[model samples]
Target: MVDNPKESAGRCAQVAGWLTAACQAGHTLLSEPEAKAVLQAYGIPIVETRIALTEDEAVQQAEQLGSPVVLKLLSPTITHKSRMGGVRLVLRTAEEVRQAYRAVAEAAERQAGAGQMQGVTVQPMVTLEGYKLIVGSFCDPQFGPVLLFGSGGRLVEVRRDTALALPPLTTTLARRLLERTRIFTALQHGAAGLPAVDLAALERLLVRFSLLIVEQPLIRECDINPVLAAGDHLLALDARIVLHSIDVPEIALPRLAIRPYPSHYLEN
Candidate 1:
């Protein structure tokens, strides 16, 4: 995603523009698409996704992404989509895609109430053969910005295998953080027939994610759950960002070690 330095800088400006408007509007929580845009701007790899408001449009989007697509109800209120039965996966045909779209919309209506359904997101159904890891940041009352890394997916709460690090991480520091996790140990030697996880790639992801937080001080909290890893591939499965209201100039800068989004760069 951050393949070119020039392009990456431009994307950061574009995302900052979006965040600026949202801040002026006094919105805290960003929609999934907004969150993904932030991640993408920072060079974090994410699944190709599109929004569809109708069954036919959903099918069209699915076709564009190719076969075996997934549809999930996209609503700000319905964060835990899987829990609400709002996720439909592995639609092999156009008809299946149409039906899945309807199913997800219906599920959102049933669980989240009628008007809670915003739309549906279509993404390629990724089949990961390696570990799913979590990477995120949240503002600690005492510590300010803090980074999180460890086991993810369905087992996150059950396993509770995570480690904390401060932002602006170096490759060495990121590797050390990885060393503190159980999944890292398992991934080092290869586990259960799966190929050994790409430690370097994971480390880079942690470092880049740290940079995102360092540069974007308005981000109060960000969750990149289930960063799918296989060999050398890493992709963010889902992401969300909570922004603080930048209503006052004094409160604009978070009590963070790193500076806010680079406004000077935007002037270039």
Candidate 2:
């Protein structure tokens, strides 16, 4: 997104530090909030999330954000929160927030045992008016960076509607990736009285996704699912980032099966 050099450098340091810390701790999976931080720093829009360490704190945070926010258990050991009943949605009042907090607390305890339970994450509940799409990439042992885009949300695995493209995507390349998907037709034309989503916005995110993978090879894999594409808005509702181990130095680029198109040579 054309950030200045200073901003870019700060982002580099922050992301590198997070990756390093996680690898040093012998962890590959970053918590949702942690992954969102990396995405936000890279200019990808995400719902700002806050952590509540206690029941009262959860209620207060929920009240401040107003009614109908979401509360999910936060734990380094638990990633599939929904599967573990650690997610509470559409909570409307202080009492509801308190109850939800306790519910997720129990869930976390059950999943991770006693002292392993962490706090809960609080984020405003945003309505899904348009398509919930997934934008992500992985370091392919052969192709280097491979980008992915498709239907997200609960139907992700069941539907299996997705497309892949090599990294360093231009607007044209991004559009081509989207077109390969089955839902792209419906996304382009109004379907079942629903209007088409903003293709330009999705294309922009796709391009940014490619650049993110290009610049930050430490990100071994990433998934920004349910990126709510309502009108012109593209906010990542949830993200998961997996980092390369510390054995792979952040400065060294992973060997790619194919040499990337050297666009930098055109500049200087």
Candidate 3:
């Protein structure tokens, strides 16, 4: 669970008090937006996105992103976009954008009914080399926040090679976390002369994500699947977070004020 120290400290204090009250009231979960906002505050790089209520606003946002954008229906009522064709990609023109937006909205409305509709999200397209990375967290019944990192994208569920770590991860542990993955050997020195990824940056992302889970106990599961590495910079292109019941136990979350990530680890 991670939070922005300055911005969230007050909220955390408030939530702490709320949790105490909720415990007394017999309540246990937090809402989805609340979980997402908390994670975003913790420095997890979510994609550049905007919630648009009207078609005109969606077109404006798509144009601003410079065409070739992705649009998806944003409804808590519906979970699987692929199943319902609620996602549209590679939209290059304003006409195409409008069509995509209307299509998704209509689909969501039809499938989930009118009140379940909550507009759409227009996001920028991310380019990448090699494979996508996924970082996820799940609150284990006994252990609390358990973080997982792995190869992702459409084939993530099929491949299923990944690594796991506990909270408050150190730099060394971060490196080891990558190594434990089956794809590490290929990523380090893979076919066709692909340069090694910035392991240090990857570590930082992992540590930061872990910290995010520690800080936001309201989050039941958070997944950044397909964190694309384009050249040197990494970008999280897609994400999903599930909120937990507010009644979840209040554990002492881990802190992430470690030394700056080692510069040398990325040089090689």
Residue-by-residue lDDT tens digits, candidate 1, 148-219: 999998679899999998877878989999999889877787888888887887888888888788767788
> How far out, in Å, is residue 57 in model 1?
0.7
Model 3, span 194-241: residue lDDT tens: 666777777777877765565556656777777875446777776776
Q: Which stretches of candidate 2 lie over 4 Å from their true place?
A: 1-10, 25-27, 249-253, 257-268
C-alpha lDDT of all candidate models, in order: 0.81, 0.82, 0.68
After TM-score superposition, what is the CA distance of residue 92 in candidate 3 from its true location, in Å?
Answer: 1.2
Best by lDDT: 2
**Candidate with better lDDT, 1 vs 3:** 1
Q: Candidate 1, which ten residues in sequence have the lowest lDDT sum?
A: 259-268
| Backbone clashes, each candidate | 0, 0, 13
TM-score of each: 0.88, 0.89, 0.77
Q: After superposition, how far is residue 227 of candidate 1 from its true place, in Å?
A: 0.5
